[model samples]
Target: MARAGLTAKYRPQTFGEIIGQDFIKKILSRASQQDSPASAYLFSGTRGVGKTTTARIMAKAINCLNGPGLEPCNQCSSCQQITRGVFPDVMEIDGASHTGVDNVRRLREDAVYVPMSGRYKVIIIDEAHMLSTAAFNALLKTLEEPPRHCVFIMATTAPEKFPATVVSRCQHYVFKMVGLEELTAHLQQVLEKEGLEYDSEAVRLVAARGAGSVRDSMSILGQVMALGGDRLDSGSVREVLGLAGHEVYSAFFQSILDRDLVEIHKGISLVLEQGLDIGFFLQEFASCWRNLFLISQCGQAAREILDLPLEEFEFWLEMSGKMPAPRIHAGWQMVIEEQKNILRSHEPSLSLELLFFNLAYLPDLLPVEQVQIKSSESKKTSVQAGRAEKKSPAPARKLKDQPKKTSGPENRESVPAKDLDWAGFIEFCRKSPDADESLIRMLGNCTGRKQDQTLVLICGQDFIFDSIQKNGRRKIISRLAEEYFGPGLRVEFVSNGSKSNSAFRDEAMNHPVVQKIIKDFDARVLEIKKVQDRPGFPGNE
Candidate 1:
């Protein structure tokens, strides 16, 4: 009943003693009773979910001084030595510090020696993904044919980074985050043993904050109780933790569903004033959306979706119906994107605000029925047409045409395409809004091939150049021609070009870098800007 640490007070003594991890307990229990135990094991999961704790328990179970059984008797020397982590044979090394080949070479030299006090020497390595390539190669050799009196236990939070060879040679066990109910029940036992009184809601709040780690839950309880006096209330938990209130999150979400940016902005400002980490706030919002989506999809039984208190679960169940599936799914994606931006951006608040306004304009982007209007000018002409039902009452006679504004062919001047400035032409193309980085590259590579007075664009690659035109690049070309030349002229492209453009400029203008450059200059590129006359000047609008 007395101990120096809290983990020691609750550390499981046997397979059956471990709570919230019954599945892992069963596998280890059977292996302790088997004729041959595996040489190496890989435990992959989030931290504080009993990976290292279970490894110590399994080591004691196999090497107990008494009879070898599924559970180790703590009275035995093997159990006591392992429980305190003082055993010479069972060494626990931190992979983060000892990841070099030289350190692993020393391990290889010691691995050959026989166990002095136990049946087999067990090595538990934490954070195995941090191991160097050479260290992994050395371990891979040992895993191929392990020593007769040796066993290896590797634990990591990121198994995807581990080498395939090291993973292939070991039996892997993935540890899941403990559920809410199990964590709450376990915390209740802890509170009662410590002689502290807590309501079910208070217990649930501590469990939820633990975020799936029992160790963290106990740590949180210790922090809450350190305030003194034993009356644990919901307000006290909320005040001490300073988390964004559940109602705040719920209300912000309702505002999003209703497309009310004003309500959402007010809620965001309130949370920011509390000095909360914006990244964590975004993560919490995403998590809340995820739970609501699950509740909406799963109906009543969704109560078991996570470890919320009954009151909190009821709140989500009631609120889930107001949000539609498409909206929820899009919100989930937007939240994830916003979280990423929060990490990479310097202005987290501005990013969060932009993310909310972006949600208001979603239905516009979704595909809908297509309406055809030939052009802006053509749309204007159609609008000017009179009512059709009132016309054509008598014989269908045609009206006389009006006089033409210009005698075009006599006065028109040809550019001749021979003296065209390649650099100047590319600068004009850069002004086109329809031209993205790739299309700009294509234009830069064009050669001025003229058939008499006509300028034909000769692009080096057919496939790359054609993507712009087939994908409706005419807006860009028309804009370019109007700016650099005049109306009634067109640009045509051919597959191969006779010259090359500098790749350096193209490489520098990739979309992300271009955005940074625009921000740095605080100026729009000339090509994308409209050329208009001054209001008071002659020939001006």
Candidate 2:
């Protein structure tokens, strides 16, 4: 006896045997049982959804000697011949191989002959979209008005490729993908009938990997059975499918929620050791966060929305409850951003590691409500400390009695602004024996005043303050002040918001390089922020 594959051995022979296509089954059954069937039929759907199978079953149903009915009697010679592909009255043609006009012309000529053995001659054309335009044109008249004893059935994954005239002449039925639950149940039944020891998780995984195709699921099951022997488990299925275990995702997500950088690093290392594709891992990680987001919102209601098994849904629900929605949402966004970068990167593993580190610190960055609450609490603490300082009189009195002078500089009000000329100081800096041009240009936007021993220079722009705050620039300014004024004169730079700052920012934005960046990225300059003395600006003092 010849060994038949699972897909062939389990091929549906009757409408009742076909799973997950009740509409197609119902339509075909009604037509097959009728006294007068449609002369032409069109079946359209994705691969492995039983378009060709339904067409063959219809052929058998029509030709079966028992009766022209919905069910075919395999015991009948006509049905057996059709099943074995040797029926004289039934012809199964491959549209791809016979795409020429001459091939269709021969088919047209053959259509004229009456059924030799069966009541009706059935012609099933698979992949009908592959038929050439000339061939379809040649068969139009014959297809529209075939002999009384002939029935034509055409199946195609892409029906739109068929000419409008061809489609209009036939009764069309559209097939849909099988649902996950339906596929899983069918796979479980198949395994049980085969007397294989299989876990439910293994069947579920195979069903998911099939992506709503029973034939595809069966094909995967064959490979899994070959590798897993008689007993099947979720771990073996995961290994075969190159899928990360649920625990890996849980650990990675927990690290992100705790903002544990070390744990995140270890988790990434473990993932690499598993030899998982970084891009696929990141995609799955993003999906996990999305599932968490859904669970956190709807609770138990998320089970239906997620379409996952009960235990998997419960796992996600428990993880989601530990973190707030906004935190998960933020992590989801980071994973999304890094996924794009990872695709374009040459070193995906390194990119993935960096992404993990970035996600670990996401809570500390911005937009997380916890960080905002902490900031508000710190402000309250500062206010309370100020009130406490006010309640103590001894510290205030001691400070009042102490001298207000310091060795560096003094903050005295009894001074004139004109006494310390900023322009003259810049000119002096320019003529100095060891002068710096950048330092001199920065001093142009500043005005100074003599406050006791200190020369207080107020800068119009934050950039000017940054330039002067640098160690080299500050030493140069102090040296110039001492040389131009007195030996004890000290220089102090302060940033004060001014209209000139906006003008400078606009001028910088209009520069050629910045304009090119804006044009290339379609970007806009939002604002020119003032640089604070303590934190300052990036890439500056």
Candidate 3:
């Protein structure tokens, strides 16, 4: 017979059918096959990781007439009835609903009795954490030594609430949030079985919004299917689910970079017109914005840092360059502030709108560092201004600070340098693979003194040099060495060495070019990291 709900119809009948709990599956399957399954199992994890499902499966397998085995023979009457929740010997209780002393009393009374119809009596209590103190005290005796044929299975999202007495008596099985790839696969199966038409993007979006809960995903998918009737396209998925479209977010990011609030509002309006969730839009937009910031900030390859399809990867890759890191990081702070404050206001749209303007001219807005930079830059500008240059009062000192460089070597030593001119080395680097100055400066962290024929640069981490080697760009660094440093000027990257003061300090930020980059990008120094070019990984000669 067809199960009533989607969860029922999609429930795992066999061990392999269960999703996102491989570790639990192995233990349960082995124990069941040996006919030595643990009497009491403490199923703990985040919601919808199949704690209850495993309990029910264990119940069915143990009472199975043909054999209490790993794989239940669904054809058997005992297995079939248990699967349908009609088995005479099995009782599934919700601790949240029946959490009083009376409930435990009733269970205590029922325990001594033998199995009425099947070989074993199984009680599966869900949300077991909610049972009252009296209920737990009352449950102690029976749980310690129940009838030979009786077994107890408890499931909870909050395992911490249960008394130490209760946990000591049972085997503990933890459920975890399902991995994205695993959840995505499970969703595809559901869609295929339901005859739902969806693309990879739609699938990924659903899985992400699901947030690692199998039941949650199924429920959301169910609601979405109800809204769309049958076929779930990405557009309908976004619409019904009130999800902001990726393109909409892309446009919003572009607007922010270009400081075009008109385009930003237009994008926001498109999402709102599509009946998007206003609060959710801000949340997802913020997240999407944050990811772009990370990618831009890190110069992380799309393929290396993110797991996305070609279209999606390309979208981020294109935006990553335009936004840059510091700007994105700065924008991220503004968005967060807007979100925190918006919760109190009655008009979320207006709050976000004002926020848009705030972030728009934010580059012009003074950060804490701008005062010092202003004092210095003003002196330089006034001296330059004396030579017949006409400008509108130097744009009102919109940029704060002299960038990192204005702080001088002492102030800037705390940050990475921006535009350090490495003489012919810089011009030479611009033509090579690691030409991006931002990247080149980060590479400087690995710089070391020449040891004989080779320049032994110790990378703080192997992954940095490993990454360069993988991109086949190591040759570029080698070529630059040959051009500037000389022939056989080997660039030997090693790991497992201590970091340098210049690398960790913002000395580079003191450079004139570094100051310009800070002003141009309108970014602030947050944190810096150094990677060692160690041996073995992307190993060297």
Q: What is the lDDT of residue 232 in candidate 3?
A: 68
The residue pairs that clash in candidate 2, if any, are none
lDDT of 1 at 438: 43
Backbone N/Cα/C clashes per model = 2, 0, 24
- Find the 10 residues in a row with the least total lDDT in model 1: 390-399
Model 2 score (lDDT): 0.73
Task: Order the candidates by TM-score, highest first.
Answer: 3, 2, 1
Per-model C-alpha lDDT, please? Answer: 0.68, 0.73, 0.68
Across 1-541, the per-residue lDDT of candidate 1 in tens digits comes to 4322556687677888776678788888888866256899999989888888888888898888874777788888878988888988998999999999998888877789999888888998999889999899988889889897888999999999999999999999899999888988998888788887888877787888888987788777777777667777777776676666678787876786677988978877987898765665677788887887777666677776576767778888776655444455566777886688676888877888888776654433311101114556653554344223222111111112211234565332444333234444565565656556445544543444333324455543443355445446656765665445445546666554222334533433343434443565363331111112224211223
Model 2 lDDT per residue over 133-212, tens place: 99999989987888988899999999989999999999999889989898999888878878888888788888977878
RMSD of each: 16.7, 18.3, 10.7
lDDT of 2 at 60: 89
**Please, what is the TM-score per model?**
0.62, 0.63, 0.67
Q: What's the lDDT for residue 144 in model 2?
A: 83
RMSD of 3: 10.7
